[model samples]
Target chain A: MSMTLEELTDRTGLTVLDHLEQQVRIPVVDGLQAQGDLIVIPLAVLDDVDVPARARWRPVPPSGVELLRGAAGGNPHTLVAEPGAAEWTTEVHDRQRLAVGVLRATRPAYLIHSEHGGSGIAPGTYLVRRQRERSTQRGGQADFLVAD
Target chain B: MRPTSTAGTGRRRSATSGCGPPCTPNPPTGNAERAITGLYALLGRRRPRFHWAASPRQAVDLLDEPPLRLGGPVDPAAPWHVAHQLADAAHRLAGRLDERAGPVGTFWWTTERIVRTRPPADALAAGVSLAELLVVGVRNSLGRSVHDGLRTPLRAALTEAVGEPPGLRWHGQHDAPWVAYHDVRRRLRPGLFHPDDDRQVDLWADIARSCGWWWPREDVCVVTERTGVAHTEALPGALHGEVRTHNRHGPAVGYADGWGGHSWHGTAVPAWVIEEPTVERIGAERNVEVRRCAIERLGWDAYLDQARLTLVAEAADPGNPGCRLQLYDLPQHVWGTPARVLLAVNGSVERDGHRRRYGLSVPADLDDPVAAAGWSYGLSGEQYARLLRRT
Candidate 1:
């Protein structure tokens, strides 16, 4: 299931900058991994999140799904997988309210980004959460989602 | 079953690529005059006197009366009101075209939102048709760029420079949105609209491509030339060829009469931001967003050093080996809020192979840097301490 950055970009038609190393095989990690403002955590690692019974799941197409876009809006963190190997849903309830969606993959899935490069996920179920920082505007104590 | 063939997709014929209106400094006045004459003919009136101005600011001085007479008794003997006639004709034409374009259901609404916000490639990947892409391109995206991005700020700057405009005016180049919308629809579907409506649409399109702003009066029409210089950059994450005004050193948009505005990214700011971003000026600035933009212009480290914010706590970042997260108390009077700043280093290295430092605002209550860092990720201090890797 391991693939190099070059092969992954070619398969998905998503691109990374020429500066990133293209030949090295991306590691398929089963544990936690962070890419910029997004973090991927194994479902078993946390008990605060739950996927509802009636949650609708969408198959991750060959073109991939854009999980998050960078602050200035150019770079996108895209999740891609082989046909029929993965599915995604935003129906999960998180206690922290940071979870963007949940990813369930029967085969290896890779998250590709133009600046941060690629992060491979081993076959498993995981929760993808966006990072947030405290907001200082207007004196409200609510946290704002981190964009980058 | 999914349709595998691209027969009716209109991918080849649709002009989705480079669909935005041209931002030309010198527009063709000849075509514009002809279009205005055609529009006058449609209203069954003789052509009005055409007065050309080098810029909108100059055109404002040429008006004898307010463009819109808000509330007044209509003279029964008057031949016609040019503005009202033009508006009514355009509205009826749009109504007929909308009927032919089909009903905009929930699916169309959702797709339109995606087309407006995300990249065109993303919309295409989501199964949006090429024709729909063109619709959003010429309408939503072009409107965002020409009207919202360029015209709005320029109008504001003009208002600030001169008092409120004395007359009502129409944005000639900025009207590309609606004009191009009708033009694209008729061009794509061909027989979808009436031939008469098609001719009217063409005249409006010609005016859009040939001028800047204009004032239409009963006996006279005043058309202004385009800006002498306009600087813009790609709107981050735009689905079409959308752009916003931006210039680091000077005015983003400037006219022949020396009227212009300065912008950072897409946010319109005072000329001082681009000219002289001094710490003293930034401190006195009341707007939080403006203050932030000024601080960014002067690097975070430099601002923190010059402002001399009191340090509260510092801790070694959990995952980032050598970097330390530092917290500083923000002055209540200056910030107008109870908050602290957490300075941290970027996890990923830039193209230069050096990690960058950034600051994030945090609630003033937290004194522990690790706890503040944990708060950012929705994890407890102990939970975040076990972090393994950062990209």
Candidate 2:
């Protein structure tokens, strides 16, 4: 079922609040306007992100899923598309440890690859929560509400 | 046509013709122009950046300047032997250079190895970047190498570079020190994984190197193995090693492998519990089982709802389940701005299943009697801040 961006925000803490608040004061050309149903937010960026308090909200760590950095540097986090092959696929040996996940209905549709190695779950969207203020956002953030 | 004058080493350039070209032709005689043209044709394709000498005399003069030599001793200066010696040195040093050194470093190293001594005054003016010299070496070394077969060109190139005559040897051990780290990279990485694409191999190699784990040849799959889970299907020939078991021959009470699977309602296992040696698992189980009896009574959600922090224990290991009492705190009400605090008590008792799926809310400060029951599981202040910040 398709959910609005607001409902998506309620279920999964992913939001474009930081982007909205930060860009609100910046003066730009008329052509430079934000648009799109898919709002991408990086939990963290190398650049400064100045957002507002009204838009701030705590992120609940996704239940039954833990974000882990690949053995490679950058502490990159990803969801494997095939949770069953996790041991051989994403683990040290397989060399197929790609970051896998997509934002569905503004919630993280992660490929849960855990030590258990396999899951009965099919390759479909599953709601996931971000770790508290992981400081990155990606996916659709359309409603640009400035409540301040 | 033997080298015009070998200095009597009898090591004719012909000896390495089978290895690849730029096999220095018969040293220039009266037909210096003919010899110079042939030399340029043979080597220029690969090292186009280097200025070709207009005549044999020029080629010989280029060598008059001592060239850097990397792997062996200095060659004697002999004008008659100049062209041949340079060719020989280039061929020998080609594959020997390390890919890790990158283009510039490899160039510098190659020149030092080939020149055998200081370069001529006009070395830079001669018009060749260090990159050209390296290209010559790499190309020559790789030229004769077959691209595919049981003995593929990749293998041949590796063998030449490693300087190990019969070629690569595989022991299947991740940490085979004798093997050049690059040659047996596939085995060094844990798993029965083979990259189907070159990019995959590169990506894996990058990750492996970044982890500072290229040596000691550890595999992720190997370390992930636990009791009862047979890896023969997953790892094939690699499961010769055994894990620490509780009762030398006791039944393998392998972990659930799924998170929160150790509890009565658990479908997975805990990582911390899995880390404890097999022997420790037995003792830990008895303690966990007894606590499970209490938790089953308190009711899971009811116990969790009342407290701000929840301690979760699973059935994997009773003693070191790594389960802790997670205490929740809100400092904003007592101080100013709202702040969340998560205190994980390390030394909590396992008598009751409270450590597993139970929460406790204490007063604003740490004066509660439960605070003294265990040490704080080492979450530093910075970590706590990261954990608490909402945005």
Candidate 3:
């Protein structure tokens, strides 16, 4: 009953990962700092990340997960969070020929979206690993698979 | 209305205090000024750094990492519009790349098509339908007028910048053109897959572009430079890792050596099996500080180094486990320091199960084999990117 989130995800089933897909919410600062931003935090000063509140997705080939980098030369931007009708939420689509994992990061103080897809698992979402507090060298609790 | 100063002008200043100095209203602050003032008040102290950092485009691009066009703060909604917006943005951006490239049509849109779905009772895997895979690839390369969507923007931008339509390279394949080399990207990537009948993947048969050539692949092998388990604890020695698989699919473990090439124990899923954590493990042991300092900087080059004096030094102690390390002198990885690494994972995932995991010890940098066997590892930028995480 008390297995760390990492343990839960380590035993990740398609069901569980899929379930978290619907849980994607607006990314909290920590999620961005520690994860989303963490991945590409330094690609540059990150001049801009003008994602819209809503987005449409398609799978890219030869690789998984790319920010709609842009058509040949036009500036590329990704649509991200949206203020939902009832609450805040986000979504991801499998544009690829096959399904793959999507990573998400969130905090406990905030609310993430609830699962609504037909499948019990929200396939694309973040799974917590080792959550650390920014202010101190302490451990915090984490939930698995927060979708981006 | 005047303040009810009836008896309230307790100080009884003078005639100068008449009507509170004519109700002199200070000029109203503009919306931009008021907004700024309110922000400062809410924040309490003036954050000098934030002021400078918040200049025009600074923050906008900060959030501009992936999932294009709708580049705002990331969200959790599964909206149809979000996908459309990003695709549109991608089309726009692709156009710009061509504009910047100049007259040669140096740019092109590549796509792939594969069978991703299988009937439940068909006895095949969940995503093995090649036909489905092909459909999805076309959808990506041509769907939503993907090519048109992207090409128009590319052309306008190109014509503006240089003056020509970009040379095009469609990565996907449909019923047309039947046979020619495809884009190098079509070479086995694992992440992009879908069911044969998924609605999103169906447009390929109706609208698709054909290509004349496939990307070239190499059957190169990266032999490990060091040997045995202790090589792991030796810090620097551990970084010298490598492995050789069929230039494209999975790992090369459990293979029988043969000039004709060998077979491997694998997931057989037919995709790129990027073991990013394993790449980090090498970084953890060899350059823990760097890994901690900034992860992005730890490219493959960092792992490739001369067999450090230690391994050569280990030769003196044939009895030392470190000395009996595996040999990775592929003529391909003999660049700069002449360091060597081989990707070696347990040949079998389960002692009894046939599935295997390969631990490829790639140089943190690109070190080409120095031999004349025309040996090139042919590692793609994407593969190198696979090993890295945002630092």
Candidate 4:
């Protein structure tokens, strides 16, 4: 029943990046959204894991992975719910806030904003954190820090 | 590995190691040919009774005897096996020794390294004198008992597989309780074996050698105190560091931390804590004092807290501007080697006064913080074990 990342993507009808996302269980935050390539998974979902123990932050790219946004000025970047995926209920305080996560795989998940051209954000489904509220500057992209 | 007779027993038994025909010197057609043939024959058989000779000439003479066939030398690392056999024999001898001859703790400590680690090959090649080490080992075991003619040939054959006796020195009763010394500055400081105190002096050597001198160097400590004594009536101030409690059997149970008013059984006594910078020469007296003060003041959990924090601080990426990275929690217990961590990066803060548009990326294969901290503290695996023993 074991398959490589490519095979899992082919079998499950998920993108290569989505296949990586399927490797780790991510938490669901009510009212939380994915801005740019950013996604929020509650820390509680990691109850069975010890991510904080080693204190590592992994980054993945924000390109190509499918995500559904909230309609009509709601959370601009929210993930479309996956069928049969296990979900946990948790609260998110601010529209834009700091959050943490671990990457499920390394692949191009989203396009990098023009401003971050000098900084290397590899293509992958990253464990990400919402570092802060997205800047409201003109043409500024809602950016999330992703680390693997 | 049978119970062998004393070395003094007038009996000889040899393991059938299939050595070829007895060495008969060929008649000399020429001095050089005869010498070469003799050397080849000597080199061909594996003879076992060789002892550590005091002089080169004596070693050569010993090798010249028929029973002393210098068959191909055993593996260099075989000295450990040799020392194991020797220790087994010494253990038997310990039962015959007088109580005054001192407990077997001193003997076991003395032989710990020799029996546990491989001796250098050159030293093994030079040959070990089991006969000599046996006399010394047996003498120490006897304590005040006269050497009851135990150096039997059967005893020597016990070391047939192992070539040489590892270098060990026994100080015996003259040094009293601390009767053995190993690895130069180290002392086999023996106190009475107390079941309640849980101090197994024989095993102490393993911990000591395992960690070197990193653990606390106290002769005894109050590992646990009996409940219900008035706080004021607890371990008296006068009996602090050197206090030793003996059970009904008259064996010392544990030592007391006079300052903290707690007693520790042997098992509870922690290893030396390296608090000071100067580790080169930790005086024995100062070592115990420092250990007592530390345990009484900081405690084990506090030390772990500090150690973890130190790891986090040291792992920070100083080069990244406002590059706030920290370890959030410990890795799973099963995780080993270079660890992957849940890193928290503060993207809010500006480094070098730059407001960046994009968030930071996490690096791969981060440096191991705990290892770095241990090195910074100059703690070895054994010293680190002290901290783990508590947690």
Best model per DockQ:
1
TM-score for chain B in model 4: 0.18
Task: Give per-model TM-scores.
Answer: 0.66, 0.18, 0.19, 0.17
What is the C-alpha lDDT profile of model 3 across B152-215, one tens digit per residue?
2222322333333212112222122211111211334322223321212222221122111011
Q: What is the lDDT of residue B66 in candidate 2?
A: 40
The model with the greatest TM-score is: 1
Rank all candidate structures by their TM-score, best first, as comma-separated numbers.
1, 3, 2, 4
The TM-score of candidate 1 is 0.66
Residue-pair clashes per candidate: 1, 39, 160, 60
lDDT: which candidate is best?
1
Query: What lDDT does candidate 3 reach at residue A139?
Result: 19
Q: Which pairs clash in the backbone of model 1?
A: B67-B168
Tens-digit lDDT track of model 4 for B72-166: 65443432233333334445433433232343344443343342232333223444233223223333332211111111111122133234422
Docking class of 3: incorrect
Candidate 1 lDDT score relative to the true structure: 0.75
Candidate 2 residue spans exceeding 4 A from truth:
A1-49, A52-148, B1-95, B99-391
